[model samples]
Target: MTVHEDVGAFSPDSEWPQDATEWLMLLREEPDDAEIRARFEVWRSASPDHPRDWEEITHTMGVLRRVTPVVEVPVGRQVRRRSVIQRIGLGRGRVGLAAFSLAASVVLLAFLGPDIALRLRADSVTGRQEVRTIVLVDGSQIVLAPQSAIASRFENGRREVRLLKGEALFTVRHDAAHPFTVFARGLTVTDVGTVFDVDAQDAGRVTVAVREGQVSLGGIVSEHSPILLGAGEELSARDGTTETRTVASTEVGTWAQGKLVVHDWSVSAVVARLSPYAPGPIMVYGKTLAAECVTGIYTLTDPQGALRTLADGQNARVVHATPWLTILHR
Candidate 1:
């Protein structure tokens, strides 16, 4: 059995019995085959989970589609006269590369929509020290920072949103039957007549911070706790362990107003929080620089400016590798 099958396959062709990856690749070469086509339909309709997986595949295809439109090359540049030797070798290589690329594209297309929708978007933020608010199409709001992205799809029975990457605070509009749901890793945060924020980061870690109303979080989180969270309450789960803690809701809500406040926070902690706002890496070279205590409230629009302001207070010099990377040394 192939690894995907050995591990339990999602949509493998049982007749051909190809691995999930290979099955996807075959669709490119033989998309018209009735057996493959029927099997594909069966796989998608087999369970509720299949459509979600398919959505991820479609989003990735969108990325490739957008990227493929822009290409620049000088056409018909005669570096050398077309010789028989050059033609034979060049043709073979070109055909091989094309076939390989096509196969890869099909597999990627299978998981593109849902996965990419959950991860990439028109805009995204990561490791931000400040709380940033994003306005959605249906007049809802998303407060994102500290490695977060929010993607929305106005679908029937649900105005759905997939938090593909990072952490985000969601203020959803009230809809009884058509609830707004946020998907993160293995967990799903569904609003139960309320507004909440969910922080889903790398390593299956998730934090649900509620402001107004209550939310129900599902998945095998923890045995000791209930899944419901009310205002001023937060749920944090790392692997199998889960805990709920009460915090100042107003403090977390500060992101909605475009402010992030920090007090006596370690440089590592600050960087961990701040990295989400700036698009690229924010790293400190020395322990002295990395361990410094930071205290302040700053706007999301200007992270580098915030760094400069912080440097001025500490009497330190700020050196930036690029526009996005900053390093402070005394």
Candidate 2:
């Protein structure tokens, strides 16, 4: 394999990794052949994009492995396009392997299909560094925080919003006949014409903070009683346990204003909140450092800068392993 010195600057239309699917197909067809493996290694090393393309292909394969039962395709039967499609249950539609270029189709179906489904189902979704306000057919409004998704339905004499992921602030449109509700993390938040924020916390936990009017929080299980909250009140529920306390309205859902306000929160917890706004993964190494309490209002506009500030305040060191990976250590 002739290594190109200007491989990184290679044209996107180049033939190197553009033929990645063929390479993958070849590897699948002859996995035990040392000669083919050696040539693949040479081709992969010939350009920077080659490994990236291969990583994407492998990632798609991993997704396919998880969704489907069959793991390994037999070397002899790998080239049998119909068998592969039947195994993955893609034979139902007209989308057979014959309809598309083999490797490209596999990658697209495995990777982009799920995302397209999610986007189609979601009424509103926000990416990192984006705060979006969406108005429903009714007079109700939602302020979706970064990396959040919500599906809204205003049918059958009911107003409902499902928080599929992340946090959202809902300002309900008061209608006596239509009750407004938000379902998140296996909990239900029913509004009494209120402006409130619901956070879908990790480990099936949820936090509901009411800024105005009133709202009720209840678990999906019938045994769990509903907790009614008024203005300046907040409720945190997890694992059949619930905690309620008074909170300042100013502190609820302040991320919409490019600010993150936390009071006596652990470093790990704060990092979890900031992860949605950060460009990539933010990790904390030391248990003690992660456990340490932090209280401050950090700007969300510059997540990396805010992280460095947090590290300085906690007497920790910030390490950038890559442009997308940040680690905080004591």
Candidate 3:
């Protein structure tokens, strides 16, 4: 049941918690309203608890927004377009104090989760469809994929980057004295004067694809001996086991060129990669469709179009639940 439904009674609309919820929901519903925004600022600064209540609600909603529910499209198929906030049923205009307090306690914990720690330490971060390139002090270039983040540590004559989330393509400047290294999900890829892509995906799966030169790969790093992958090589690690494959050098980092290249990868994997470009979550449902493996190149120029094409190929359909969320159903 929704928090709104659980609260059998509500206080007057004057409470700070209720007012804060109403203001935030209204602003989100009509973000272009200047008058509403101006009034909101006044309300926020009215009292210390006003902004305090606002911040608490904002952080709760922030984490809730990312809690994508990839469940089966609701039965009866009465699909409707709604943002995550609306779907979760946070009281829109009349949230009771008790109701909001209940929801906030649960979601606030998630707001302070590991993602917050990553955000604190990250040197670079990219939002949806926002790819960024960072140049280190040593002249190496790091191209961050959409929804990606990284933290670089260059102290003690050691050049290393911790891939905090998503993926990044690194073009290292040759420095024999200090070898460049990338760490993601317990896997390590030490550069051998090369360009390589490290994709850190869900379930502790890390894929490292070398394009230009060579890289030494180690799984869980501390236990396994490091292996080498020269040009046109890729390695995927799952459960501490590694698989080496041959991928076209030109296919690496193709998302920067408006294309995504994969070989014998699952449809779910494709959705995961394309999701960074999509503003909201792109859910893939149905066992058969989710398990379907695909090959060949796909377009990233239009993530929605690419999703539709991928769903079509896998005998699934893309449903536009809202501007923020897309569902692929079989």
List the pairs of residues colliding in candidate 3. none
lDDT at position 83, candidate 2: 43
Across 1-330, the per-residue lDDT of candidate 2 in tens digits comes to 233332333344433222344455445655575655665676777678778767765665465446535324333444554343342232121222322222232332332322667688888877765778998888898998877788888888878899987789888888877889898878888889889999884668878898889987776533467778999998888787778888999788788788999999999998987766776657675567789999999888888888988999998766543344455655
Candidate 3 per-residue lDDT, tens place, 161-260, comes to 9999888899999888898889899888888899989988576788898889999887584466788998899888888677888988988887767789
Q: Give candidate 3 regions above 4 Å deviation.
A: 1-114, 219-225
Give the 10-residue window scoring lowest on summed lDDT in candidate 1. Answer: 90-99
Question: How do these models rank on lDDT, best leading?
Answer: 3, 2, 1
Backbone clashes for every candidate come to 28, 0, 0
Point out where model 2 deviates above 4 Å: 1-121, 221-225
**Cα lDDT listed for each candidate:** 0.57, 0.69, 0.69
Give the residue spans of candidate 1 off by over 4 A: 1-139, 143-147, 151-156, 201-204, 222-226, 292-295, 312-316
Give the CA lDDT, 0 to 100, for residue 326 in model 3: 57
Q: What is the TM-score of each candidate against the true structure?
A: 0.53, 0.63, 0.64
